[model samples]
Target: MLTSSTFSYAIGLILQSIAARRTITSNSIERGLVIRLATDRCYAWGLAAQVAGFLLAFYARETLPVYLVQAAACAAVGVAAVMGAVAFGWRVTRAEAAVLAVLTVALVLLAGAAEPSRVTAVPPATGWVLTALLASCLALAPAAWRARGAVPLAGLAGAAFAVLAVASRPLPALDVTALPLQPLAWLTLAAAAVGQILLAAALQRGSTTSAGSAMDAVTMVAASAAGLALVGDRIADGRTAWLVVGLILVVAGVLAMARVGTVVGEPIRHTDNDVADQPITQGNAR
Candidate 1:
C-alpha cells in the first residue's frame, strides 16, 4: 500500500507540474483557454492518481494506526518535491536536503516503534461512524469559511483528510461488490473528495511550502489522535518515547522542507541574448 501510494502520488505531482508549466507559457487569452483545457486533462489524471493512492491508504489503515499511515503518506511531499526538481527545474537547497533526510530517518523509527494493529473481523458501528463523520465536517465548515490564506486552507484540508482516514476504518473488507452497500465507504469517498478540493485550492492560493507544511502537520496530529482515541491503536510497548521523538522529528522536518520551498521551483528568467536568438512565433510581437 505504501509503495502504491507513493508511486501514484509521484505520478500525480508530475502531471500537476506539467499542467502548471503549460499554464505559465500560455501567450494569449484564447491560447490560454486552450492551454487550460489541456491542463485540466492533466489535473484530472493527477486527481485520479491521488484518489487511487488514498484508496490504497484506506485499505492499509485497517491494519495500521492512522498516524503510521499518515506519516508514511507525508512522504509524498518529499516525493513530489523531488519530482518538481527533476521535471520543473525546481532546486532543493542544502537545508531542504538535510530536512528530507531527517524525515526519512524519523519515518523509519516510527515504523519500527509501531505496534501491530489489532484486527477485527467485524466492522465498526455504522451509525456512530456516520454521525462522527458528519459532525466533524460540520464543525470544520466554520473554520474553512473563515480561513483567510493558503496556510489555513491547507490546515483545513488536512483536517478533512484526517476525518476521511478515520471514516475509512469501518469500511467493509476490500470487496468491490460490497462497497456500494457500505455507507461508510461512500462517506469516505466524499471526505476524500472534499479534502482534495480544499488542498488544490490551497495550492492555488498560496505557496506550496506554507500550505503543504500546514496540511502535513495538521493531518499527522489529527490522524494520530483519531487513531488512538477512536480506533484503539496503540504504540508499541516501551516505545512511547521513541514514537514521540519520531513524530516530532517528522513534523519538524516536513515544516523545514516547506519553509525551504523544496516542492516549487523559483521562477526562471530568459536572458536578452537567449530571447533574441529564438525564432519568432505566431504569438511573438511584430
Candidate 2:
C-alpha cells in the first residue's frame, strides 16, 4: 500500500541525515558547502532514497490528500530519529519519544478523516501560480540563506516543496507524451532541484528539530490549504473535527521538542591520503 511510502520517506531522511552529519566543514564557503553536501559520497545513497520517496509520493498522491501526504512527510523525521536509535546507536530523549507517539495518533486521525477525490480540472491560473511560486523560491534563496536562521531557510525549503507537490498534483492524469508540453511537469523538475538543495542546506546547518519541524510545518499546513482550495482535496463526512484535532496534536508535538540543535557525534574527517585511496561506487555520484 502507498501508506508504506512513509517508511521509504523515513529511510531516505535517515540516509540524508547521515550524509549531512558526516560532511566536512573546513574551508567551505556557503555555496561551496551546499555543493559539497550534494556531491558527498554518502549523499548519493541519500539522493537515491530521495528519488524513491519522490516516486512513492507521486503515486500516493493519486489516492491520498496532500495534507495527509505531507503529514507523513513531516512524521518521516520522527521515524528517522527512531531509525537512528536502532541502526546508528543514536540515543533518543524522552521528548523525542513523546513526539513520535503524537505523530502516530495524528497520522491515524488524518488518514481516517481524509476522503480522496479525483481532481478533474485545475484552473489555468493555478498551474501558472505554482510556476511563479518556484520562481520566487529561486529568486529568494540567496537572501534566505543570508538570513542565516533555520526558520527562514527551512521555511523557504518547505514552500519550495509545496510547489513540488502542487505541480505534481495534476501530473498523474496527463498523457506521457504530453508531459514535455506541460508546464506543470517542467515546474515539478525545477521545484525538486531547488527543494532538494535548500532542504539539504537547512539540515546541514540547522537543528534537526527546527529544520524538520519548520520545513514540514509550512509544507503540511500550506500545501493542505492549497490542496483543498485549488486541487479539490477533501475530508470525509463528520471527520472535520478529527482532522483539526490531529493537526493540533501535530503542532503540540513539534512545539514540545522545539530547541536549538543539530544532529550530534559526527565522525572525524579523513586525511587527504584516505580520500585519494578510497574506492568509488554509485554512492559517490550525484
Candidate 3:
C-alpha cells in the first residue's frame, strides 16, 4: 500500500541523507565510492517500491477501484512524515498533527468511494510523451548543477522529478522480454529511472526540507495531476469532490509546515569538517 511505500521512502531518504552528509564531509575516495554504492542501493529499492505499488493497483484494478489504490498510495505521505520526524529528531506540533489526521481521514473516505472497472489498455503515444518529457528533465540537470542557490536547484529538481513520476505511472504493462520491445513501456521506465536519479541528486545538493519538499509536495503532486489529466484517468463522482478538497488541505498543511524552516526530513551528525551552509539548530528542526 501507499502507507508502506511511504514508510519505505522516508526511511530510504533518511538513510541516504545521513550517508550523503557523511560522504560529503569525509571527502575520501573510499567515502565517495561508498556514497555511489549507497545511491545505487537506494535507487534499486525505490524502483522496487514504485513498481510494486503500481502493479498492485493494476493487478487489483479488476477487483478493486482505481481511487482505492491511488488513495492508499497517498497514505505513503504519512509514513514519510513519521519517518522524517524520527530521522530528524523533530517533534510534530499539535496543529500539524491535526492536519495529518484530517488528511488521513479524507484519503480513506476518497478510497472507499471509488468505482472499479477495467479501462482500455495504454496506447503508443503515451510512450513518446513519456520519453520526450523524461529526456527534457534530464536535459535540465546541467542547469541544476550550475545553479548556486538551493532553491533553484530544488525547483529544477522538482520539475525533473515530476516528469519522472509521470513516466513511472504506466509501467505495470511493460513487457521487457517481448520482441523489438514495447517502446512505450521502455520510455516510461527510462523517464522514471532518470527522473528518480536526478531527483535524488538534487536532494543531495541541499537541505532535506528543500529536497524532500520538492520531491514530495511539488514534483509528485504536479506529476500526478499531469498523469491523471493526460492519461485520461477520471475521478469518480464523489471522489472528484473530495480530490479537490483533499488537494487544498494538503497544500495548506504543506505551507504551514514549510513556515517552520530547516530540514526536518533527515538527521545530521556533526563532525569537525562539516560546514553549515544553513545551520539548522535543534530548536528549529521542527
RMSD of 2: 5.3
State each model's CA lDDT, in order: 0.66, 0.71, 0.51
Rank candidates by TM-score, best first: 2, 1, 3
List, residue by residue over 33-62, the lDDT tens digit for candidate 3.
334745555445654655565455444443
Clashing pairs in 1: none
Clashes of 1: 0
Which ten residues in a row are the worst by lDDT in model 3? Answer: 22-31
What residue runs in model 2 are displaced by over 4 Å at the alpha carbon? Answer: 21-29, 255-286
Best by lDDT: 2
lDDT tens digits, residue span 1-286, model 2: 4556667776776666556645543212366766777677667777787788788888778778888887877777777667666765667777788788988899899989999876645788888888787788888877776665456767888899998887787777667898798877888898888888887766666556666678877787778878888888899999999889887777666545444122232232344433433222212211
Task: Work out how many backbone clashes candidate 2 has.
Answer: 1
Error of 2 at 134 (Å): 2.3
Task: Give the TM-scores of the predictions, in the order they appear.
Answer: 0.77, 0.85, 0.69
Which of the numbered candidates is closest to the native, going by highest TM-score? 2
Alpha carbon lDDT of residue 7, candidate 2? 71
Better of 2 and 3 by TM-score: 2
